[model samples]
Target chain A: MNKLLRAGFSRLGRSCVFWLLTSFSAALAIFMCAVCFKNMNAHGDAVDAGQLMLNYSTLTGVVTAIFASIYIGVDYSDGTVRNKIASGHRRFDIYLSNLTVTTAAGLFSYVVFIITVAAVGIPLFGSIIMPLPRLFALLGCIFAAASAYSGIFTFITMSASSRTVSAALSLLCALALIMAALTCLGVLEQEKEILSGSVTDGESGEVEFVYSPNPRYPTESERKLYKTLLDINPAGQMLQLAGRAEPDFKLIPLCALSEFVAFTALGAFIFRRKDLR
Target chain B: MEYVLETNKLTKMYKHSAALSGLTMHVPKGSIYGFVGRNGAGKTTLIRIVCGLQSPTSGDYTLFGRSGGDRAIVRSRRRVGAVVETPSVYRDMTARENLRQQYRILGLPTFDGIDEILRLVGLEDTGKKKARNFSLGMRQRLGIAVALCGDPDLLLLDEPTNGLDPQGIVDIRELILRLNRERSTTVLVSSHILDELSKLATHYGFIDDGRIVREMSAEELDAECRKCARVEVTDAKALARTLDSMGIEYRILSDTTADVFAKINVSQLSSALSSSGCELLTVTERDESLESFYISLVGGGRHE
Candidate 1:
């Protein structure tokens, strides 16, 4: 409904959380840019924007989670949700409006951060490595990841009544998931170290060197499982997308987009059944 | 009678208790219907359900002409507004900002009525002051202002004057009366203060144990609680016979006492009683108030 959108957008525009997160993200982006510029000035070789973006997985994921959680949580704490429902707006419309606004805000702040970083990083670190279409695909992946994060955080906000608890839990859970995904990626990236086992000297039948293979490297099936976790987890997809892996349409992007759909639907469904009292 | 709201066997059950059990009542159009009940008696639950904040477990209700599950019911709800339990406002925002948020949500083309509603609720001067800093009465008035947006045909106020001083109570009372009398807006107000409701309600529904124990117009309630003469005599048998000959509506209380509904010449009754060999001991006029009437229905011993 138009009324729902108007109300939701107004709230989003005036939300302190939106402004705070935007500032935080802008500061982070600026800090990264300054560090890159300093590195280029001192070493004559600027930091790679690709590596800088890779770290955005944890940064953007956690920040968006905090933003979305606190944004929706205030509506519940302030009892404004009842106003919309009492005004004859459908529950689905209210939920959808919040989702749309939070997603849009998330995307907007992310773009601001991207532009701020690009303003410095492109000139110093060099232009984006990929072609135009490929860059667009990567941008799409980031947007999808941001939407999924919004859905998840919104779901948590609607499920819990206490704003403080919802925000803390959302932040903690998002970070925990990112850590889990990072650990899985770390395991996948472990290389098998060559260990000489039992080398015998040709002249004397004496064992000169003894070595064995490092078992810390993931097996093929274990590697598949870790890859699946990385693909399915929003934070993991964010990390993988940031890494600029051959942007095939199959894994990380699909996971992020599907999660966006799934979490939004699930959040809307739960909110519809929620009682304001 | 044209009813603005009607419920059929509405029941709401909590995990361990039933807040409302088979509550079926009607609010006639163009009347200030008072919903009287003690705490935990389903007053707020009924309001919440009708306002779409919660769902009735196993019942249906109709607003205007639309049933609960019908798509048109939403349109019907556009004609209704309610403040359930507490004022739903953003505490950090100023009063004007709060109303502006509500106005935008109500989809009014312009902010035309925002100032008008603020003036109507006596909050026009609450400029730049956040609702959290306003007094309780100011917040209450703001809540009513929010409900008054869109000029709804029916308004529901739940304990609108719960924590107000005498002047605040009078302000809210006068506001409700002015809205009803000037606008013909049907109001369903729930409150524990019977005397306060008595001054405002045109119709009364006495709810106890989650049921409507009585529903009547003000005139009917007045007649039931009207002043009457109480006469104590030596023998009610002879007094009844004497009053029957005089043709007065009366209720016999005991063998030696009776309540006489009509005014009578005490001297004539004394002379008639003496002729019947009965002594007239005393005569007193009495009228039960709304509080006593509610006690009679819900029992005088139980406390809210």
Candidate 2:
């Protein structure tokens, strides 16, 4: 297993996709920081350092999906995976090594994002107003979310028989998760009641506000389900990390860890049975 | 003889068809074993299963001394190298980098023999060019170079000469012969080109419909496909009678043709046939080729 990891990392080091994606991540983070700096100057308002730092999480899921799929997919497409297997490396080791490399890649990009946010963001925006404990907790959740993204995409790419199919499925899965999370956030953010404009009082001809129930408001059971959905999905966790709403730091990490383990196990199972040409 | 690989009743079934059904064969150590079969006759399937790329649905094989069901089979596989169907190479990497990657995978002590291996495969001069830019023959050689890593004892090459020009084919053949002679590497090469296989194989396994129709040594195949004298005459019966008086073994193929399995004196045969009033038309020496033998074994068609 260590040998497999060493080889995997060596390959990962030379991978053009890894370097390109890492550069892209850093560039995107810097661009976002500049945009925030410009906004701060125009509006004369302090930006939240934690929010800006975690902002990269919103796109990390998609980026990790692309990187993980293409990174692992090349092995199958180029038939290099046969070397490892024919060399007597265990299938589980190959799967885990790939998962570890991709997870590390995802975290590497996030680290760059954080570094960019600190270097450019601290001077432009004031220091993070969020408490240190809360900030650390959110950072851990984001890391876990990134790991989950890697695990899921690794599973898809490893189980898929072809490179193209794996890449397409992984990208589609990432997009689908984001859309589902957005729907959950939308439903969870509904107001119980809204002011439906003004009505004139019949006696004094005075204007009065009228209240009506928000039809989209979820029931108690629905709220719990939606909240759970937000806590479990990596994209949903990213939405919370980006300060769309308060995050369940404990539950999100726990769910993300479970996803990592479960996907790794399932992926190993499928890959072990796959017949290669 | 010690067999490096032995399969017993090995079977592999795809979704709706059996790729290998109770197929069994043996590859002797220090021998170039030719795996002969038509297309989709389970040549690659068997190779894949042996290389651990796929698994047998039933039955099992023993590699080195370890059974397929045993955990030690993994360790045994470490001594085996293979290029199945096509060369397995990283197109994005240079020849050296690809060898480095394989060395890393095998957990070799260091990149010690990488240069030597590249030189052996004739890729030492391909400095920094990626495998993607390599021509077909170059890529194939690189694949063999990668397989040569760790100095594997058993080398499995499935159709190693496919898609090669005449010169390319000769290069691969010489390489295989050199490896076998110098390193004593037991090779199992599956190919549709019987003529090429005949040039290198010390042993042969003919497969048809997923089962081995026959397995024999080169000497055994030679004996089976005997040398004969094809004789044409006015009447084969008359010629046979004259040849019978001479105590010669022969098979009459037609009224005017017979394959004599023994040496005959042309002058004596002509005089004897003339006395018997059976005119001798022609006498030509013939030897059955590997292709003809394979066709005879499995019945004939467009082989590939």
Q: How many residue pairs clash in each candidate?
A: 2, 0
True contacts kept of each: 0.70, 0.79
Candidate with the greatest TM-score versus the true structure: 2
Docking class of 1: medium
Give a tens-digit lDDT track for model 2, residues A68-93.
Answer: 88889989888989988988888888
lDDT of candidate 1 at residue B247, scale 0 to 100: 97
Model 2, C-alpha of A15: deviation from truth (Å): 0.9
What interface-residue Cα RMSD does candidate 1 give after superposition? 1.1
- Against the true two-chain complex, what DockQ does each candidate achieve? 0.70, 0.75
lDDT of 1 at A167: 88
Cα displacement (angstroms), candidate 1, residue B169, comes to 1.4
Model 2: how far residue B121 lies from native, Å: 0.7
Candidate 1 off by > 4 Å = A48-55, A194-211, A244-248, B231-258, B261-267, B273-285
Best by DockQ: 2
C-alpha lDDT (0 to 100) for residue A100 of candidate 1: 85
lDDT measured at residue A3 in model 2 versus the true structure, 0 to 100 = 84
Model 2 regions lying over 4 Å from their true place? A200-206, B230-262, B266-286, B301-304
